[model samples]
Target chain A: MSKAWTFGENMNTDEIIPGRYNITIDPLELAKNVFCEVKPEYVKNAQPGDVIVGGQNFGCGSSREHAPIAIKGSLAKCVIAASFARIFFRNAVNIGLPILECPEAAVGISEGDDVEVNLSTGEIINRTNGRRYQANPLPDFVLKIADAGGIVNFLKMHDIQEVLA
Target chain B: MGTLIEEIFSRRAGGTVQAGEIVLLDVDYIMSHDNTTPLAIKAFREIGKPILDKNKIVLHLDHAYPAPNILAAENHRKILDFVKEQQLPHLFQQGVCHQVMLEEGFVTPGSIIIGADSHSNTYGAMGAFGTGLGSTEIGVAWVTGKCWFKVPETIRVELSGHTQPGVYAKDVMIHIAGLLGMDGGTYRSVEFGGEYIDNLPMHERIIFPNMSTEIGAKCGLIAADDVTIAYLENETPAKGPFERIVPANPRYERVLEIDVSLLAPQVACHPDVDNVKPLMAVEGLEVHEVYIGTCTNARYEDLEIVANILKGRKVNPLTRVIVTPASARIYKKALKNGLIEILIDAGCIVTGAGCGACIGRHGGILAPGERALTTMNRNFVGRMGSPLSEIYLASPATAAATALTGRITDPRGCL
Candidate 1:
């Protein structure tokens, strides 16, 4: 079980990882600055396996893969938002960051709640309030990519030319 | 029944493809810029394969041009080393990748192109399936010459009537973005129809797809017509013939129609592209700076319009105005036409052809609590320097008028 970090809607990429710190593409370097501006105490308070919850339209700006890399590197287990911007959604999948779309979990879960996620079932159980929420399940193809730790690793296991062809 | 996007995918797939279907497409061209190219090159190296085709790849140095600092300079050095080693055919140090791609004839009708930058959709003006992709995807494409796509549903936007004087395509796009919320067209394709689109020149046609990404559309498409043929002949005559894809009895999931004649000079208020309002509604708000450039609105005609509006007039002493030509060629043409001189005489700061101030990196960084009126798209918070500063989006006419008055004044009566 992990504590929750709640955020409001329309949280853009700049806020997640401000453009100023974007000079480096190193995931570990980027992780240090994740949510630095909007949530300065994020690094100090966030423990491993903590979850991030946001309202609608989270990660809605520049197509920076660094945003997900930073989040995943920050030791957050996964992100739960009502909805995500298209490019950000794709980036998360490409980088192996687990994200769920659950409007109920986004609004109902409070800060510091102990929540558990079941990737195969798309279930989010709120142990703090004894509430449950359902997430949109991923397609089998997408799941395989996620399970293999992202597109690059997944590609390593298959003949990209034949699989894509 | 297939939409224009579906038809393009179908043709590429050698069969009939529909919306929501995933297909692997052979990319005609793929590009990456300074900030993203290093990552793509690294990934490409990890693949341990020779590039699928060097001629099909392009590397541009526009994003961090003139390098903001020593670190940025180092990053440029790395990209240059990779390009030299790989023997990439096309490398541009002169202008934004999108503008250079079109002006140099890299884009053709019925082709599929993807770039590391999000605004790559600008190529849709030439009837190509151009869209943005992540650096890894671009890396994968560089190695394999293929990328996957889930064909998106189409939104038919039928524009009718002629544009009024001083009202430009920039205004029409801002109006549409406001109507469709910021994410309204998410994961969909926006196709243009009706008389207004038919009458638009190539520069104006580029504006629709250039800004379509702001509305969250996968890509914006306009079918090739007589104007497209004329543009290709005049701009890229050396290129050979290419097939043009037009949807046969296209089926759209939704349709939106707008009359251009009814649109007034419009502005997307601070912080949101969707918070659009008529110039009349927000007139007289003080502005500290006025910037005109970027792939969205900076072209020869754009500068010409600004020169026409600012002729014999000086910018407000308090309002600093900066004008940038989209490409070096356009800048030379504007100089030949005396537009550059006119702008300089009117107290405008003219700069080289590149993305100067749009990304908040260099040309004109705003101070906290200051405000600017610009022709660049995307005014998200801190997009142009200070997070406390605000950016107002408008057309060249509106930008010129605002520069002269030191306030958000309507451009209709100025000209």
Candidate 2:
């Protein structure tokens, strides 16, 4: 169970991690500024096991990986949204940030609610509200990549690079 | 049975691929710039492996060039050292990554390409499956020479009819953005077809695909034909062999038909790319700056139009006009054709052939409360400097005309 931070739709990349802080590639440094422009209290108030609930089209702009890295670096467990921009979905997978698409969770989960997401079974349980929702299940390959803590780790353990190359 | 994008994926996967199916395809080229290279390097090191093939990778030092400060300078140094240590041969210190990739002939037809920058879709002008990926995925591609992709549903767009004088490809693209909405093409592939596409030159073909990212498209494709072959012959010393693929009884998720003749010089207003209107709708708005350059509209054909408009007339006394070519090659061609001289004689400030002023990192940062009409894509707030500053996206011809009046003006009469 993790607390929830609710946000509106069309939250662009610039609002997630502003371009001004893009000078450094460090994830921890980027973590200090997540949602700096839109939600000033986010960096300070967010906890390690918290969850983010957003409406449609979350992370819509830019192909920057900094957005997901910042969220992961902050130790957030996962992000549950109604829908995600295509690039944001791929970027999250590359960086090993779990994301679940559950429209019910997006609408039903309130701020400070204890939300738990089960990626394999596509289940979302809101302990605070005593409600449950079904999330879209991820494909086997996508789950494999995320469970391995990103593609880099998967490649390292399986020697898939040479096999694929 | 399949669309152009589906067929391309099927050929690469060695079997039939449908929309929503995931497939791993070999990448022909991987491109990155100064801003993204540092992160990719970090990821590549975390993987603890060598790049699959150094020859297929290209690096450019265009963004924040000459170092806005010590931080940027140090990052450039780190990238240079990594390139030297890895013995990578292709590095361009003078051009934007997209332009450099095309000039070096890394983006031929019927190949899969990826870059760290979003404008990588520009390569799809040659019928290639080119798109942008994040730095981490780029790092994965660097090490494995492969990336997984979901076969995106295809939206077939049939372009027809001709534009009046002064109405350029930029106007058509902006109009389409208005029709499709900013996120209409999200998670989809867009392909151009019909007779109007046949009449467009390579310079114009680049814009449709280059601006496809504005609509969140995975890739934008135009099938190869004789025009593509002729363009290759003129641009590169050698051409890669390519056989055009046409799907038999093709199926598209949806089809959109556009007539350029119906378009007036279009402009995307402040804060959004899809907040579009006719040029005349916002004609009287005063402008403080006029910028002409970017991967979208900095081609020789675009500059030729600008030079013709500003050949003898000077820019408005209140407005500042800045011109930057997209690449060193285009700059040299413009110089040889006396376009640069005409621009300078008309009081335009000519800059280097890099992405100057486009990214707001260097060269021209708009002051607070300033308004600019530019030929670049993306006019989001705080995109070019202070959030108070505003940007209007338009064609080079419209930009040039606006420069002469210090206001958003149509290019028809000025030309």
Candidate 3:
């Protein structure tokens, strides 16, 4: 069971990861700086398995890879949003961050609600109401990589990294 | 199944690429700009190659030009350091990559163009297959002359009817983003056409593919017509035959059409592309800044429209309005046309053109609590330097109106 950190609609990458600190290459420093500019509390203290739910086009502007990398580093197991900007979605997947699209979730869930999400089945159960919703589970390929702790590890596990090398 | 541009670029992509389709594509033309080149040059050397073919590449210095950032200035130093070492010839002073390519007579129709910046789709307006890439991937491609692509499905966007005055291409793209919510065209190419698009001026038609990335499409395309030819002739070595591209008999997976005749001011509400609505519905929203420049809408023609509206008017002192042309050429033309004076006299600051305020890269950045109304693509949160500062995405006319009022407004004010 994971607690939902229900946020308002349209939580952008700057709210997730600010841009001023983009020049740095250190991932830990980046993780430390996540959302400190927009939501100061999150960067300083965010529990694991805490999912950030947002509105459409969550990531926009500047093709920065740091946006997704920082979010993943902060231990947001996944980001469930109503929709997403194209580049951010691709970057999230490419870097192995889990971003699921849940269009109606905006109206259904509430802040601080306890929920159970079965990643393999895409089943979301609201602990408060004991109601359940079908999550339209990710395809097998996504699950395989997500299970391997993101795509890079997936590539290493399946020996795909050898090809690029 | 067969997109006109894809059919022409990778002619061999169709038929069948099954469960395991490993294909090698001989990249036609590759491009790199200031920011990505230094790192790319490093990667290429590490990978062991001078470059597969010099002619197949274009090195642009557009990103950090005029106002060189620390990293890009370092890149410029490297470009100068290896000006002859790399044996490259596609270098130019930092300028807008899209306009520079067209003016220099680079990019031909049905050819593939890849650059480090995502908006490289600007060339797709000229009918070239252009897209963005990361530095490492570009460096590898420069050495190998090949890059792998998972063929994307195509979505046909049938645009018909004439636009109401001042409703230009940026409005049309915003309308599309509103219609097909952001993420609607994930991993797809938006093939554009219809009677409405056939007659737009060259600069106006250039806006479609420039911002397709807003809602997420690889590139946008339109069939070549007379307007394209007339514009091509003025440039260097005229382009080859006008490759007329026609939609398949049945047409795209999904067809969405917008009637420009009756459409009114539409705005992409703060934080999302699809948060769009008729302007009358959400008028009077407050804003802190208004920007009028981007690869999408900062051309000479676009500036001419704004200049007409701001001729004698003054922007609200409460609102910081900045207008950046897409290129130095457009800036010069604005000066020639007295558009620059109109902007200055009317309280608009016309700065050197190079993607100003669009990405908030260097020029003007807003504090967290501020809000900005812009004419460039994408109103995604934190897009214009402030995650807390809201951004309202609209047409140049609408942006100008907001500039005058310091609030989200319709440009029908001047009218």
Q: Model 3: per-residue lDDT, tens digit, B48-153?
A: 6557788777776655465436754665777677767777776766357777777677766666677766677777777667777655456667766766555566
Q: TM-score, B chain, candidate 2? A: 0.98
Query: lDDT tens string, model 1, A41-71?
Result: 9877899899999988788767677788789
Backbone clashes under 3 angstroms, per model: 0, 0, 0
Give one digit per residue, the lDDT tens place, for model 2 in B1-415.
Answer: 5888888888889998899887888888888888888989988999998889998888999877868888889989999999999999988987778877877777777789998888888888888888988898888888888888899998888999988888988898999888887788888998887888889988998899898888888998888888887877778754756677765577888999987877799999997889999998999899999999888888888999999999889999888899989888899999999999999999899888888888777777789999989999888676677768899999999999999999999999988
Q: What is model 3's DockQ versus the real complex?
A: 0.17
Model 1 chain B poorest 10 in a row by lDDT:
B236-245
lDDT of 1 at A31: 86
Q: Which stretches of candidate 2 lie over 4 Å from their true place?
A: A1-3, A109-121, A125-130, A161-165
Clashing pairs in 3: none
Residue B75 accuracy (lDDT) in model 1: 83
How high is the CA lDDT of each candidate model? 0.86, 0.86, 0.69
| Candidate 1 CAPRI-style tier | medium
Better of 2 and 3 by DockQ: 2
Residues B271-334, model 1: lDDT tens digits: 8899999999999999999999999989999999899999999999988899988888899999
Give the candidate order by descending lDDT.
1, 2, 3
**Candidates 1 onward: DockQ, in order:** 0.53, 0.53, 0.17
Each prediction's RMSD to truth:
1.6, 2.2, 5.0
